[model samples]
Target: MSQIFDFSGNEEFYHGGSIYSNPKEAGSFLSLGIVNHVDVYFPNKRARISAPLVPGGESLEQKKQVSLDVLPDECLYEILRRLPGDQERSSCASVSKRWLMLLSSIPSADLCNKFEVVAEEGDEIESDGFLTRSLEGKKATDVRLAAIAVGSGGRGGLGKLTIRGSNSVRGVTDLGLKAVARCCPSLKSVSLWNVSSVGDEGLVEIANGCHRLEKLDLCNCPSITNKALFAIAKNCPTLTSLSIEGCQYIGNEGVQAIGQFCPNLKSVTIKDCPLVGDQGVASLMSSASFVLTKLKLQGLNVTDLSLAVIGHYGKTVTDLVLANLQNVNEKGFWVMGNAQGLQHLRSFTISSCRGVTDVAVEAVGKGCPNLKQFVLKKCAFMSDNGLMSFAKAARSLESLQIEECHRITQIGFFGLLLNCGPKLKALTMSSCFGFKDMILGFPLPNKSAPLRSVTVSNCPGLGDMTLAMLAKLCPQLQCVNFHGLPYITDAGLLSLIESCDAGAGLVKVGLSGCVNVTDNVVIALAKYHGGTLEVLNLEGCGKVTDAGLVAIADDCLVLNELDVSKCAITDFGVATLARSKQLSLQILSLSGCSMLSDKCLPFLVKLGQSLMGMNLQNCNSISSSVIDMLVGRLFRCDILS
Candidate 1:
């Protein structure tokens, strides 16, 4: 055949039987012809025919089918690098001996994220063996050991270390942790979850040795006392963030030490630390006045006596959380009420404080004029008068949460909404009897001040009219949560989804307790903004099914966190969510999804690398095998019982 020929001169490609005259088309046509001939000749070895075989140093262009053997080392390395993580890399190694050899030769730093030492159950020498192995294999020295002892005759590592343990490791004493800390010199972040054995001594060792430590999470570590704070303040002068939530032994003294010594501290959280009183918090605020910007003091024993002390020194705080301050009364509020320098404060949460009346609530609005986020839940005494105060004072407020407040009636709520409509971007109103029918008829935000989110849960009075009104006024609303509104049906929810401005911004939604809502509403949401929705809490909702979940998983690319706990979803829905190829999901809660079984757990294992939190509490079908696989895959995840 001629290499080059005009259409008029040659009929080889047109009239001839073969389509191999042109080079580009010839290669593809020849490949197809060869594949067909191979399949016909070697029917039993058709699978083998698909596998490309080539000689060493041969180019990929020489083979009809692309051969893995001909790829350059650098090109193959790049291809392996593009795989998701080590799990995927390991699967690729099984393809052939070349891949397996290449993966084994690669450095641990390039092949692994971090050194992980996992101790088997009832293995006495497990800790020592793992530590010895880790010390022997040194590519880059940052190790994470789970449920393994690292000090006090256990095992020790010289590299940067992270020690995480469960309740099963009762022998993991403070001395054990201290031994590891004394051994390691390059530690940066120490996150201790549910490890009650660690006390002040162990923490002090970490503070002293890890001078460059930036993050310290001690959640549910109850034995951490004031002595730990002294050690931290004295040694880790560069500590920037510290969380001491659920540490029962820590008191005002520890906080005072942090205030006095940690000059560079920027964030501090003391959630559910009952011994940390108002005075201790006040001392911390006064000491770290210039540097502290993020402070969370939830469930502390702070009272009205310390309000003045906090207000004086905490004026510069940007993110402040004081939820469940049971002793916070009118007096304490008045002290903060009169603060003059709290204009910089942005986010504030003061929920579950029964002592705080409308007077105290009003004072905060007056005192912190620049406050943008305000969460006031179970504040029984807050009424229309307090709403008036907020309207008059806090014009910059954007997010407001007023749930379980019985005193706020429809008339007052409407009046307050009218004032906040211009500035409010997110609003949550729940369990209030007064705003029932009135909210349905009330006008909402203007074009200039469009609402982005609204959550109305357990509000029995809210009907179709109220939703229609909200849909009309807040055209830019991205999320609307109506958890317990029985009156709302598919019509109301459909209207809201359809009214989404340009169908781009609406992301999350909740109709959990809306008994009237059916599959129709769920389908509507899945059809509209399912691509962007990340959280869809349909707990106790009997309407949704596998069809709706499949629709959502297929459309939503960014859906990461989902809470379908207690819903009637079956294994079909669970399988769909677990097998999603989007790769963005990180948390899935199927606590009460009874129909889901162990069949879908393998998919969860495949998808578990990115997951950080998962809840499978009451899923009876899941056994120990699934748990083992999940634990192995999700190294840094928090899995609840």
Candidate 2:
């Protein structure tokens, strides 16, 4: 008897006498089992055929798959040009050699246009460069630096490069910088922070290669010395801004080189450089006097002579900051003011300096006629007399900030406020222990001052009477912030807000840490200033409850930002806020409100529709899973849980 066998299924058939129909039978098959003549029919359409295995049992006719590499060069170039950032393009370049070449061939102008498009969509793009790259920590490898140097050649030439920290064993060296120097001639700004591996050799390479360098910021880079600055001074003539902080080896010589060679330098900030003394500062001031507009000297060993030179030669200087200069004396500050060369000075800030005395401050006020803003911090010797004298001298002064000034008593504080010109628009006072409600001798001004904002913080001596006095003095105040004032109550805040002129309404009010503030203040805000009030921060006001939030939701139609953290708010309050039709709040903070739980999740998710930022930190009662779900739903909102 003959049995027919079909090979259409590609199943193996054994030549045994008995039929072995099991397809699972394993072994090589020599022939079909008991088969006579068999005929096969063919279809009209072509069918895929399995090729016979080779000696190694691998198929020779493997299928091919399409990929980005297979695309045309022009197509790849367009794709790379549309990448959001250099890091993304760099990642794509690592895929293949063809991609790297295509990415490098992209024009700089096209990359710049892509950056502009990204910026318009609210993404941060470096202002100084059309292309920017940063290498940090372990990623700061010479190989990657070399790659950036080669890859960024065609993509608008790296506009800015930042190298921060490096690998512990082996990191970026002179070789990497040399590669960048050789390739990126259009480099404009370079920032090196805590990158100890890089020294003068690498910096000089950059200075020699990138002649268009405009800004250089070096912070805690101990390896850098004077030689690099000299090279930059000689080569980079268009250098406009230079900041050197904690670079101990960089001394007067480097600064002097910059002063002499970089005549177009507009801003110079030299901080904590022990070697920088009178000579370097004087040279920089005198040589670059024509165009220098801003100067900041902090933690330096310079003396009065430097200040004298600045006063004499800083004719074009408009902004000056002097901080932590123990070597500078009152004589130096007085002489600087007496020079009368700071005619164009607009803003001056002095902090943690022993030389800031009443005499020096009064002299500065008398000299800088055009000075518009003045800030003083941690000046232990500065008293009310100095403050009053300065206030009287600075006629163009529009803003003043005084912090940690212990000697500025209520007399001097009120005297300065009373003597200040109508141009004064903003005043900030913090940690002034001498401020008190006592105003018996000082007479209040009959007409409201033109001041638009006032911030008084941590002054325990300040009381209700002072707030009433300020309310009467600055009725047109649009912004008020009183924090850590234990003596201030609802009545004090009430007086300040109620005293606002009919035409002038409070736009921003902050009563943070004022435990005595209650829902009454919120009700008052919703009643009088609700139409114009846009920012209300009542954080740490334990007395505030759901009633306050309900009032805010009902009346504060144009409110844009509200902070009720650490208040006695519950789910009902959040639900009320979420259901409000008129409130289009963009930022909301309910951190530390222990009463909030998973039940408030739906309401918060509803509120997240209009919120750009929400802080739910320390709300331990709310489940993490709920927050995770809310995060997935609120794709547009930034939640900090």
Candidate 3:
């Protein structure tokens, strides 16, 4: 017989054999039998000559436990790369020490195409840059990070590695940072919040090792000084966005270096760095190749000189935040007003800039035509004159946060709201004592009141009528916070919930200091809108007792956060939350609840890992022993005392 099978089929080749058990058609398997020739084919690939097969003599269980040495390394890698997450890959590595070693030898980047991968769902909020990984708390330790670097041989295509500060991250040091720099050559972004151990030297190591770094966030890393900035200016030319918040030592020299080297820099945020004066800022702006866009300078020492430079060269700027720059007087804003470049400004936030008066504000208002967001915090000097111009010019406004702006009265403030029409979506006027009932009394277009969130906390002048009007006007409001409005009673709460689509849309409701709010409103919420209510805060409402809490515990299964702090609730009220199987509560604040004790701990312990935050501050009856035991059980919860 010929060595090659001469049998032919439509687009199929056969594996031929001199002696065969059973002769079969192209693609089907041939059984073992006495025959002259055997022919078999595979669907996708060309067929080869038949060879004697050896059946696995091992048991089925033994085969599963066997090492992957039988398969080629490439084949094993190909299979492992398809896993969904790191946890799944870790699971595969747990089969044996050999498997573990094999996986450890390969870079995680090679196993997955994505350079950076967020480990959890919440990480999306913090994810920034080309490759960003944000793992909140101490889920990722320095030791673990170092091990990953060593296992992957530093060739991991990771761009960003963000480990948010928590209790465990305090132990991380330069040793771990050095390991990462030595291995991961593709690292572009690194955010180590509160990692004080990493000094200028470690930063230098990163700057030298990863030159492609574009975005860097070193929040609260106090140890890093100007040396780190100098190194970055020399090495990192592609740097664009940089946040050196609370790094007190780096000043003018560092800022000057950034100006000289990083010509492509777009956004630069520096908080609490008083040494960076106008000279440093001017040098940075003078040499910039591209238009400067975003700049956030928040600190007591940031002066008018820097502000003047911003107004002079900040024409291309879209988002401007000059927060906490107390030294920036009305004169600095005058410079910005004259700068015709600020005409295209979209978002303007001058928070805690106490010197900002109506004179400078009025100029900015007249110039900036496309202002989408305007936030004025602690700018008490700004009066109706500035607001009138701002509101008239900024008809495209969507969000307004006027916290601590006492000078802005109903007329001045409403001037902006009146022109907002349907464009307004969020309104936060906390501590604006000027707010009165009439501010919200005016009729708003039901379809045009596109307001999704309304927070008017500490505005004591507002009453039940305002709340009722808000609900009636904005039926789709998802969050309503009128915390310090004492006059908002049960009638308003019920009317608000009933008139609005609270059952379907309202997720957060805050009546924190409404002393008159009672069980009637609480029971109404559970009966009518418990399903959509995720966070319900009745803090300081002394009238809400066990009956109100019990109603919520029984009906609101989806309540993730509940605050009844300073309320007249005892262990019975706290116990109701722990006993409820349906309520997988994440945050429970019982601060100042004098009657709460050890009796409630057992039920709370049942929540296990579900609880994220628990405030038991000033609970005189709850002894230290109960707290100790509770902390031991709920290790992850932020147990505040």
lDDT, residue 120, model 1: 57
Among the numbered candidates, top lDDT falls to 2
lDDT of 2 by residue, 1-641 (tens): 02211234344343333223663331112122211121111223322223354344444332332355543465456566767676676688788766655554454455634444356568844334378999999999777776787567546668899989987777887767876776577799998888888899988988887889999999999989999999999999999999999999999999999999998899999999999999999999989999999999999999999999999999999999999999889999999999999999999999999999999999999999999999999999999889888988888999999999999987886777788987999999999887767655656667767799999899999888888888888888989898988788989888987888647688999999988999998999888888889999999999999999999999887999999999999999999999999999999999999999999988998999999999999998999999999899999999999
Q: Write the per-residue lDDT of candidate 1 for residues 1-641, one digit (tens) a residue.
A: 13322223323333323324565664453334333222211122121123243334222222245455554565465455445444565576667656654553343334323233455553322112223222112221222222121221123333234445443523455654554454344455677766666688778877865576666777787787888888888888777788888888888888888788888888988899888897788788888888888988788888876677767777678888777888777888877768765668898887777767777777888888789988887788878888767766788888888888888865565566566636788888888866665344444545433478888877787787667666775788878778788888777778878888755656777777776766676677766777767677776677777877787677777777777777778877867876777736778777867787778777676556677888888877777678777777778878875
lDDT for each residue of candidate 3 in 142-163, tens digit (9 for 90 to 100): 5555555434432334577886
By summed lDDT, the worst window of 10 consecutive residues in model 2 runs over 33-42
RMSD of every prediction = 23.9, 14.4, 16.3
Q: Residue 50 CA error for candidate 3 (Å)?
A: 57
lDDT of 3: 0.72
Which is superior by TM-score, 2 or 3?
Answer: 2
lDDT (Cα, 0-100) at 416 in candidate 2:
79
| Model 1: residue 68 alpha-carbon error in angstroms | 50
My TM-score estimates for the predictions, one after another, are 0.58, 0.80, 0.61
Clashes per candidate, residues 3 or more apart or on different chains: 1, 1, 2
Poorest lDDT segment (10 consecutive residues) of candidate 3:
26-35
Query: Over 4 Å off in model 1, which ranges?
Result: 1-170, 193-196, 219-223, 246-248, 431-435, 438-449, 490-510, 518-641
